[model samples]
Target: MAGTVNRVILVGRLGKDPEIKYTPSGMALATFSLATDESRKDSEGNRQQITEWHNIVLWGKQAEIAGEFLRKGKLIYVEGRLQTRSWDDAQSGEKRYRTEVQGNRFVMLGSRAEQGESPESPRASTAQPTRTSPDQPLEEEEDLPF
Candidate 1:
């Protein structure tokens, strides 16, 4: 292929509540951790499971939505690109790098009540809709031939 793609898709549970912050220019930024698990049978036929934690970042409207709706242990589907950032530690003066998924779109996979939220709340009703980047066009069910 002549072009390169930097896309990532992940389905996981949030490890904790998202942290929201604002940039100097007043842009919203949110950060959170997601835990993904893998299960298999060991050589001894014992069930084994491994969990991987990923750092996730959301910006703009996505960040705002995450801050308002996401909570610990909530299942979510995230689509974005991997980004690595480097910064110098203030105390050690050492360069540190961290890789995070910069989420462009996301969907809450389960019902709000399952996450300890009220099902009848307005936010709950509105929040379940899959959110995508503003640049992406929304596709309606009628648009599908099937």
Candidate 2:
């Protein structure tokens, strides 16, 4: 490999409505939290569902679009790179770090009923998505190297 890849793709529901703000330079900025889920058998052979939370950030027009259309519990697909930023905390005087997905491309997911949109509204709902296409077969556990 000549170069490294730092891409992250997430398909999840918004934990809350996106919050939008403008920079001093008048650029749009949006921030939100997304939740992804996974399920597996525990040591006792009982199934457990786990949810993971991720910080998501969007910029410019994408930020504006996300802020306006994405509501809490809405399903969405975000594609972007992972970034970790560090800052010093004011009260604690300790360095704080945050890892966030700097999403560039966004897509709406799930059916109209799931998104609370009318069946005729295309803007609010979509059939699954690219990576989750039904035509593709899921890889079995044995196929994974780990």
* Top TM-score hit: 2
For candidate 1, lDDT tens digit of each residue in 108-145? 87776786667753332232223335654443422213
- Encode model 2's per-residue lDDT on 1-146: one tens digit a residue: 55677778888999999999999998788899999999999999999999999999887777877776789999887877787999999999999999998776677787767777766554621222222224434332222131
Please give each candidate's TM-score: 0.78, 0.79
Residue 97 deviation, candidate 1, in Å?
1.0
| Model 1: residue 30 alpha-carbon error in angstroms | 0.5
* Residue 15 accuracy (lDDT) in model 1: 99
Q: What's model 1's TM-score?
A: 0.78
Clash list (residue pairs), candidate 1 = none
Model 2 lowest lDDT segment of ten:
124-133
C-alpha RMSD values across all candidates: 4.8, 9.1
